[model samples]
Target: MTFQAETPKDDSARQVGSILAVDCGSVFSRAILVERVEGTYRLVACGEALTQAATGEEVLAGVRRAIQRVAEVTGRALLSERGFPIVPERADGSGVDALVATLSAPPPLRVWLVGLVEEQSLASGMRACQAPYATVCDVLSLVDPAVLDDVGGLTARLQRLRPDVVFLVGGTEEGAEGPIRRGVEALSLAALALSEEARPVLLYGGNSRLRQTVEEIAGPAYRVLAVENVRPSAERERLVPAQNALEGLYLEKASHWDPSLDLLRSWSEHPLQTTARALGHTVRYLGLQAGMDVLAVDLGACTTTVAAQRGQAFTLRSLPGLGMGAWGSGGPKPSPERLALWLPEAIAPEEVLEVAATLGAHPCTMGQVGRELLVEQALARECIARALERAGLRPGLPWDLVVGCGGFLGHLPRPSQAALILLDALQPVGVTVLAVDATFLGPALGAVASVEPLAAAQVLEQDAFLKLGTAVCLEGRGREGDLALRVRVRYENGDTLGVEVRAGTLEVIPLALGERAELELRPGRGFNLGPAHRGRTTRVYADGGVLGVVVDARGRPLSLPAEPGARRQKVQEWHWALGA
Candidate 1:
């Protein structure tokens, strides 16, 4: 992905102008036009088309189709008379001021990790391999004698991998280097065994002292990059340098195959980023600057991306084969039975599994209804759960906010369906505001932010995010029919409504978008709204969304009846209550 500023049109760095940001996803290529109007940034037009990266068609074909759609929507002559995208604005003021792109179109970047210890540097290496486009093809350790036989076993394994990059992680700058050096020597030996063309790029992110030694061992034939140690120590990690290096390698491989990338390279000052990493960077900015911890999930057909922030630290993890689309043979595939649990009585587990496999083979947005909807929801829930678990984020009470992105969340007919799916999947507790990226602008904004921070920030604040009201999930335990929480909401108009919510049910109170209300909630003896407000009355103000303020009286660790009839009936009740 690339972002090109309008040079002839405007030279000022901070000046407000128009930008066309394109996001290339696994299944779709989307473009959103953000322009300065009346001194504020607003999304003027947006368009999408299926991504053709792996479909035997040129990737730029999909990019052009999506951009053309946006051009039509805005009634702007974004393309020149010669049919090329006009740069630096047009004489008639028809084209955009700048262009940027975020891509998730290419396959996962293959990486071979050579770390010292499984729990120390290997663990750090795993975190470094958390890039959206990264797939750890092989993790070789020097300690493993079975694989490192006296002959060529280790060399044979490395040759078979044919990885794009070899990530050497472990050891601190001031600490151990012997074990780390051995690992580097092993990599050197492996490189020597493989042909020059097949030799992987050596990225040494281990002990700082071993840099020159590693470079010498790899020789001039291997391309070596000495980045920051992923594990500065056993307890601390500095993983961004290695991750960035890996992303650069991914782009390097992509550019080699697609000449369109070379064109974009010349046009853009900032490097392209994976969709998930872009969103993760956006969330990181929000968390650090806005002072709010956030959890964001983007579900794709081929991979599931989870981005989250806790304090100043941010994490973005992508599980490639867990999505609803095709996956590589070497990666792990999600089980079909795991997706069948959320479905009703009519849809058998085996039936759901069959449909899942087919969708995995061939992904499409159409024909999604009835059993298909159930399967999608089930798959979404599983993906969300898996992402959160892998990222070590069990979003319970006190989460600042949670945002949902992707086709499933945005295209669902009812806003409540998306909200309910998030609720079921994340099971977030306490007072947490929910929102959705309706225009799929998070990744675009993220890419734009690298070039123009203000442009991306303004668009995100004014246009990209769609308010989905606030969810008040009463935490703790309660009897089935017992009152879990009682809410008294005072609207901006001075009108008040009170409701006593029983456990095991979801209640939706009507509140229009942009409407504000002050809420006073009191939970029952065992049930709690939050830690400090357990069994106590707590008051807070909130803004409304499409579905209004939803009170999920059903306690955290939400459960449904195991019996088929009861589960189906309960699910229907909740669905109807939420207007889904």
Candidate 2:
């Protein structure tokens, strides 16, 4: 619960060994070893292993193998003759240093979402769990007898799954308690079937019921904790505390099952909630060091998590059904109707679905056809929009940076395409910047941040973060072949430049850091940036980052012709504008 940096002790420092950080996700586990050399912490080596298996013992074995591999690479002999890694004598590991490990999986937590209604409150609870990296193994909402029977079935399913935790939530501020109460009773019955050692941890965040009575019913059999309701009122959400509690439970209880968990415990003087700690640390590092808001999406096979930090406040949302992996198959696939709305006129609805289905199914393939690329971008855009909306981010809010993390975006051969996917997907409305996680290391940085804030901050700025330059957009909606917009830039040095673009045009301008430009935009016919504004002028600031200035002309609802000729013409115009 308490994360503090290890301070170096003058005499005990010599006994310190090295620090190792590991992140184990659903698909992969990675380890990074940091050793003190010449009075500074230097990355010694990194290694990875597949976490294909699901059991706790399997995961632990994977962690051990990963650590041993990394140690071999570094030739550091991190493990003793008996194979146990050394623990740091000093908090800072002044001597040889110590080995600290953090594991990310075993799907340690399971939560049940309870709400007044299946669509609204239940949806909110599920979203909250998804955001903060918790899985909603089941959802219970008010329903008829048949629905109640379905809920019973779900409870049975959960008992079989044996989730380590349950998130009980329901009702807005002033709403009915009958459904939530009934759901709780069902959960209580389910808890009775779970093992005493494996008794589920329940988090109550529902309508004001008899707290004592509910606790009495569920607590003895399960570890029950209550927090503020997620939906206090119909329109308001109070999820931060409940989310915090979930993280606490994960770190305290669930982490013990991780295969490398004991090894991590031996290394870390304090407990660490691998995922939550990683996310929290990254947000803090980005906010404090960069002095800018950051949005990161980690899309996995089974779920997609979005973490955003603005100032001191942070929010994480999970979209369980939005991933491109096998687990996402049963959820809503991108509708061809929606894709038809964004595609150029030439692409047929069936064609769009073909592209979407390929990406939805294989998610790992790349170098899609130009038309397929467009459709994929459209799907990404929709997913981001829905994810952000669920996280309570209103459209038109100023977002300084958006970072994409996960296999689909991170491993892309062309970073530009990845950036384009995120830009189109999020449809960020204001002056924004973009980047990709390159390596899925946010969680690792987060874990380090919990212990050594400065180390985490340094790694984030110097090693972790990849800056995509400033993005300037004249927000608007338009159709294919429509003259979408034009932007003119006037530098402080008295240089002026102008560009005309159509819908779906992505343009990049090379600009160095510490540079500022005066930008004017003409929203053109059939497109409006903001409130019928025309030829608006604004200042654009460019930070010397990885990818420079990108001007996105992809309009909202990103209109494209449904007809072949018109769509091709529109695509041609967009390509011409970009000199493609």
Candidate 3:
């Protein structure tokens, strides 16, 4: 499948000023063109097309269509007659100077983990596997009761699982090697049961002294890659080495699954990156740039990822089977009753179940502004909640900024609806800025950062995100109608607006984008804003977003009414309050 944007013309005087990025996802192929406008990088145009893999079409067919759409919208030719991106802009302003791609269309790599300790080395190894588009299908550790009883079951399970990679991690550096040697011996026995082609690649991340032994035990039949010990000591853990190794393996496996990727890979100056990793890189960059803690959530068709950065500490959790799309296919689907918890209207559980099933089979289906949309948003809330729980973020620790990425959050009918969903799902504490990737360019920006850091940074700050305003979340419970917080907003223009918020309600102050306000929050007795300002008056300066300033006094650990009618009514009221 070749993609032709326009007829080639001969002119060689055009200056290089534009960068093109494309992201291939499971459901959609998106393309964006960024050009230097008046000496600053700005988002010039964006295009999207339905990913064609579901229909037995060439994977890049979707990429071709998306890029063509960009050309059509921008009135600039981007591809040549040979169906390849024209590098170096011509005098006719046809080709892009740089082209980059981020992909999440391929399935995650299947990894089987084997380690000595369940909570130490194995835990670190599991986190490492999730760093890329790889899922830990099964874990076999010496501490497991089943393995303890029948040591031989390890080989049986290995053959049964037939994982793409066997990640073996154990022991700290200079620690005992006898147990790790035992693990290698078991893996060698497992290799005997399978043919050379069927054998899984072994990644040995254990005590450094045992590297030679591991390679010798696996011998020539198994492909063994020795990485640094994930648990170098009882008090320290290093996951970068193993995580880097897994990312390479993921790319290799993805290319194998779809040879079409090789063609896409050729267009990039740097190596192709998994969308999740690229997004993480962007998140980390934002955190470092702001010098504050940041958290980002990306809910995709097949996976839900949450990346949190606290100071120098960063944690990323990508749960494969907890996404809103491809639900019930292999990922865990939320129960109808659970989905009902976030519905603003009285939607029958059976109907929710049916819609969810349809979405699972046909992920491309989108809902209009009605019950279907509500159901989808409800599932999205559940997905984010589950992802946050998996990320293990500390409660009451204020996140400086929370960014909502992906289409489900970005393409909402109103920014208010996006705000409500984020507030409900994240339940952030204290003064936190809420933003969304309105352009769906997070992965692209991250991918481009490798080749053009300035482009990524400038585009991100100027046009990529839509600030939704600052959120002030109270952390204490109170009677439904009782006073929660007495808030006073002093705008930069010297105007003041005061409002009283009651428990179990959401309130929005009139603040426009680019506006600034100083909030004086006085919490009611037993109701605190956060750990920082418990039952006291504190002032915070907040920047404006589309929704202006939001005061969520619905209490920490937000709860819904048990009665169906009351829950529906309360949720509806919350939506109305947010102007969603």
- Return the top candidate by lDDT: 3
State TM-scores per candidate: 0.92, 0.73, 0.92
Better of 2 and 3 by lDDT: 3
| Model 2 score (lDDT) | 0.62
Whole-model lDDT values for every prediction = 0.77, 0.62, 0.82
Tens-place lDDT digits, model 3, residues 193-307: 7778888889988898899989998877589998998999988988889988887887887777788889999987878888888888888888887787888899877888888
lDDT of 2 by residue, 1-580 (tens): 1223344566454433356776656555677765545654555666766664444355655666677788677665555666565554344332224344454454435676655666666766765674355667766555654555454575577767677677777766577766666666776776676667766777787765545656877866677888877777777777677777876666565456543555556555655555545665676567656677778877654456778888777776655566654323665666776655445445777776676666656655544457666666566656766777877775555577877886666665466666656755666655677777765567776765555554554455446645656776546666644776677777768887777776667677765555666666666655555432333444445554445567767765445666757766765554443333
Candidate 2: Cα lDDT at 535 = 37
Residue 554 lDDT in candidate 2: 70
- What does candidate 1's lDDT look like per residue over 1-580, in tens digits? 2233223354464563788888767688888888878866678889998767466777777777888999888888777765566776767878777788787767778898888788888889988898667888888776665544443766777768778888888787787777767666666776787778888788889888888888887766479999988888777898889888888887778776666766655554466767887888788877777678788888777777888887776778877766656422233454664554566546765676666666666675534467777776777787778778876778463666888988768887777878988888888877878898878887888877775776777777668678888999877778888988889999999999999888889998878898999999988878887664554889988779988999998787777777767877888788778876
lDDT minimum window of 10 residues, candidate 1: 1-10
Question: Ten residues in a row with the worst lDDT in model 2?
Answer: 89-98
Off by over 4 Å in 1: 1-16, 81-83, 145-151, 174-176, 326-337
lDDT measured at residue 350 in model 2 versus the true structure, 0 to 100:
75
